[model samples]
Target: MVGSFSDIGATSTDFCNFRRDLLAYISGADAQMVVEDMYKNKEMEPDFYFDFDLNEDRELCRFFWADTISRKNYVCFGDVMSFDATYSTNRYKLIFVPFTGVDNHKQSITFGAGLIAREDVESYEWLLKNFKTAMGYTPRCVITDQDPALKVAIPNIMPETRHRFCMWHIMEKVGDKVGNALAQNMEFRKALNNAVWDETLSVTTFELKWAKVMQEYNLVQHRWFDQMYKARASWIPAYFQDIFMGGLLKTTSRSESENSYFGKFTNHHNSLVEFIMQYNRAIGEQRYHQKQLDAKGESSFPETKTPLAIERQAAAMYTKNIFYDFQEEIWEGNFTCKITCKTNDDGGYKYTVHETGGNIFENEGVEEIPGCYIVPRWTKSACAQPMYNVVWKACSNTQGGNELRTIANQLWNEFYNCMGLANGCPTEMDIMLSTMQELKGRLQSARQQTRASTTPQSVIESILNATAPAEIQIKPPSVAKNKGSGKRLKSNKEKATEKGKKKVRTCATCDRPGHDSRNCPERKALPDE
Candidate 1:
């Protein structure tokens, strides 16, 4: 493209420089709204909330923000959040903390984000408080790694919130904290995995299995083992079976998933402004993927495996990805499930489903899905539920009445119906495409006519009043202290196995043989190993 510019009577450097510094200026009192005036535009509480603190020298110190869409997402999926702080996402080494949750699509959705100059209790407290303020309520549950600062801050900030450690984070450390021989032993790994992940077992049974595994592996006296056992209530499913998010994320941690998802658009060398721009891109991509899944759920349906009426109902109710899982359960229940007990209840007859080598379930009815309890959130209709729409309407600026809203919704419905017609009548696609093109041209022509009808003085006023960008006085933050944690500490064997070589690991600070860090070290120290 730069080379082609020469043919168009421009040099490469000229094109590049012009493109780099290009700006559009708007100015004057008429065009600009004061912060106070904007705040007064809404009578209700603001849909967005952002807060930042400055140091004694008036430089950026800590910041947190959540937008309208994110806050709306919180209203729907805010029952659970997976949070962890990451570093090296900006040049000043600010810790990037993202509060992420799972949506109806079973995909990660960000609730809010923060960039803190420090990773201490004070900084985290400020960040969480801002998040709570933005979303209007605390999440019912939160999953996080065992961060020291968060351990102190979250409970103090939101005592009612159910806090738990990520099981995957704990499981990842097994090989690191334990010796290589035990870690490599398939029998030991299996025993430990079964002990931690088997929710079917009772709390006492889980404890017994854990004790047997620890005893067999000679890890009972290990410091790491002891700490894990002490915190079993936080991560172990046997202890928190009633938590709505326990099964969704306890076994497979989304903290790491959120980290990787946001990590794609950020880097250690990014400036504050650069980081914000890229962060927006990351969020746009995240929401775009969710939209694609939503479209797929609406337009497609998977074929049922069995001829069961329940399967057909399930296929209609669930999204494609979750339907596969439901299908597997329905298929397996045919063989593995047996009715062990049936008892009468006020509402209906309650029967106990005894599955082979799994947790027993007390469900209503025998085979009909309508009579049984279903998780509405996992269904295709989850996104369309009127409850969430109420939240959106409350926050929205469009203060239209029910009739106007219905008409607006009908426009979209008709648009989708057209798409369906196009799909159903594939042979007429060429005509349909031509009709759409003609409609687009007509709309553009109408828009141009309306713009041309505007008074020339109005356009002249805008051009005359436009001004250059306002100067910002705030300075960037100094490099600050971060938690310097988050990633699992990989053992020598694990690292070698992953990289396919026995490389010499070294102390990052001293460069004495052992670690690579994305977040650079503040000071030199010996390797913990």
Candidate 2:
């Protein structure tokens, strides 16, 4: 029953109370003896034995002891270093997390320190120094956000080691700045994505292509590109290129994925120590899973597949031919034809053609002609040309002359009009004259009908004539003056009172009624308290 209390609901507080009660029960001289007996009995219990050493083989024992003893001593020997910083909720925190790369399967965190000021150079240097002390040696590589502080501090502290920017952090920044439009423009997006794999092209070429992509999507130029370019040499892990870094010299998405795991435990915990413990436990579980995965021979990760090479090959083959075909369609016409071919310096061919006396009246390349142009019968006959015209003459009713030619000419003109081209059709003036003559005949018929239907009547004589131009009548000067004087008096009154008077406050000092605060010297004096 006494041991059951320790087993069932044991806590530090509970254990402290238990210790006090046991001490009081045993009393003064027997307390130490009773404690030793209790400890030895608890140690002998199978449950306690199993809890401490259940899977403790000689190898496991050696590893456990070595890790335990070395970690304390190794506190001064830095081995694994991680440089990570985050800015959220308007506060910046950097963490130099130290770990021991004990086995391929395990990394034991030796020590970690949180930095309040990420941007300060001294703060980052302090973190690196702490990391160096926590692990057994200087870190081989420091992974961090692409922070300027880390760039400076990492090199200064561990000059021989590598510094890497986190790929996930950069991508997040790209999303925030460039936005979904980068994804919307598929070609530009592919170009940007492909930039990582383009080793044949120099970094400068990649940068230029990147700029072109940003321009295509109308994204503002960002500092991230400069950061990426600067960190290209070190951040790309040589051995882990394809396996971990996606074959690019950029940060991995692992940090972000880890951060997300941490986010789940963030609720209602105000203690930093609690947060760290929970985070470490989570990390342990993740390591366990990763170890299982590794045991299954699946530790190596696959690189992201970039289709840039295939796309470039396809584009190179098709682009020029497609452009030529489009231009040929625009130039298609029928005529007496002349074709000219020229060879470019690059071994490519350019073709030009001129077509005369046909509906299709231009030249085209061999590639440009439509399938209809190759019809055997149409090719043989000159009249079958796209723009062929037939001449026609007017024929009397008694004898129809050249009716076929007239029909052909009308059809040709109609086709020309449909094509929005002037191929020698009659002018608008001719159309207008013919329309007016037809209208004149209709007008004459209407006039004859009106004449037949109506009768006119007139008066016989006028008895008296009216006189011309009566003498000019004008108002007397006195009446005009009286009329004008009334308006003048009103105008004079309006002029005298143009705008209403503004109320003016009297100045206290000057004792003048028209002035306000600006002219009041009394207002400028200091008031007595």
Best-matching candidate per lDDT: 1
Give Cα-based local distance difference scores for all models.
Answer: 0.74, 0.41
lDDT of 2 by residue, 1-529 (tens): 4347554545888666754543333232231232233244333331111111111221110000112222332332232334344322110122323232222222233233242322467756755564544343554455677667777988998887766666556655554445456546667656766765454466566667767765766554566656665655654333234222211234543344444455565433112222334544665575566446344333333221233343232222322323233334343432245554544535655555545643232322244234543321112121123121222222232312246658888978975675454334567545655776799789879977886765321110010011111232211111111121233354332444564454456776676876676767676675866
lDDT of 1: 0.74
Screening candidate 1 with a backbone cut-off below 3 angstroms (N, C-alpha, C), the clashing residue pairs are 505-514, 506-514, 507-514
- Prediction-by-prediction clash tally: 3, 15
Alpha-carbon lDDT of model 2: 0.41
Off by over 4 Å in 2: 1-82, 86-119, 175-183, 197-249, 262-529
Model 1: ten consecutive residues of lowest lDDT: 23-32
Lowest summed lDDT over 10 consecutive residues: which window, candidate 2? 457-466
